[model samples]
Target: MTRCRYCNRPLRSARSIALGYGPTCRARALAEARAKVIAQHKPTTIERAQELIEDGGIVPLRGNRVWRVVSTDGSTTHKTAGQVHAWTAGLRGRHTCYHRVAAQLVALAA
Candidate 1:
């Protein structure tokens, strides 16, 4: 017999040993830990951009020779003719977005 380090409950069966907590206590603790991890690493601007582009949820609109990519979240990136030309030339087979560009730059560094 052993007591759970977290809940101080008597652990007798294999199931209890595996959980190391009473069922209710184990579930609550797991939920709390998951929330903490999520809160710690909330999505960044670049991350949100990558997600939008990867999902094909951004639409590119052209006006007066300028290009703009708009996301459903109302985020928009305006590009000059030169900037758009350079981006298309450099993108090759990879995806491109003003938001995702920063994220991809970070990912490459990593």
Candidate 2:
């Protein structure tokens, strides 16, 4: 039996176009997509942080420690390293290295 990607519910039919996602999952996905489109039109804190990181205004800290702050274009500072560390530590796979965290940060910033 194929399982839903978002909710892990069993697929009721093989002909279902939304193969792995259940009805609730499909609705949630649609809602999230719509919200993302709306969000793109407005500059939120996340968007600003992404711009700062992409513009090289933020640099990942050295060593295995997981906390760093970056200066924004207006001399404001944004901190994301601690959040990243906490997220990575909560993962079930192999322990995440500092390099992995750095890469993830860069990706998130982008």
Candidate 3:
């Protein structure tokens, strides 16, 4: 007898046997797989930070730990330190901005 991939329950139906998952487990696995795919395609904060770094938008301030980050639109700029905490709307809470992320990447490279 075949067993479910997720719950380890017996798979009696031909479809379940072919899929190796019971009906409930198959639905759960499919949902999980869809969520994973969506997460992979979504633009994350770290990816945005990396884009800022790659675009030469981050510059150190006066040999200090502070950095200047330009917006992608080139209409605004923000100053942040390597350890500064910023509020991100997308994150809905306090988080580090691209300036700080660029600084951390530079530090790691050095």
Worst 10 residues of 2 by lDDT: 96-105
In terms of lDDT, which candidate is strongest?
Answer: 3
Cand. 3 Cα-lDDT:
0.65
**1-110: candidate 1 lDDT, tens digit per residue:** 77886778788778768867776777676677545433444356456645655665433444323434444466654343312423453346353344435333222222
- Indicate which candidate wins on TM-score: 3
Worst 10 residues of 3 by lDDT: 85-94
Instruction: Write model 3 residue lDDT over 24-46, tens digit each, in one string.
Output: 88778767754543354335755
RMSD of each: 14.6, 11.2, 13.8
Error of 1 at 94 (Å): 20
- Local lDDT at 22 for model 2: 76
Error of 3 at 98 (Å): 2.9
lDDT of 1: 0.49
Off by over 4 Å in 2: 43-110
Off by over 4 Å in 3: 1-43, 85-93
Q: Which 10-residue window in model 1 sums to the lowest lDDT? A: 101-110
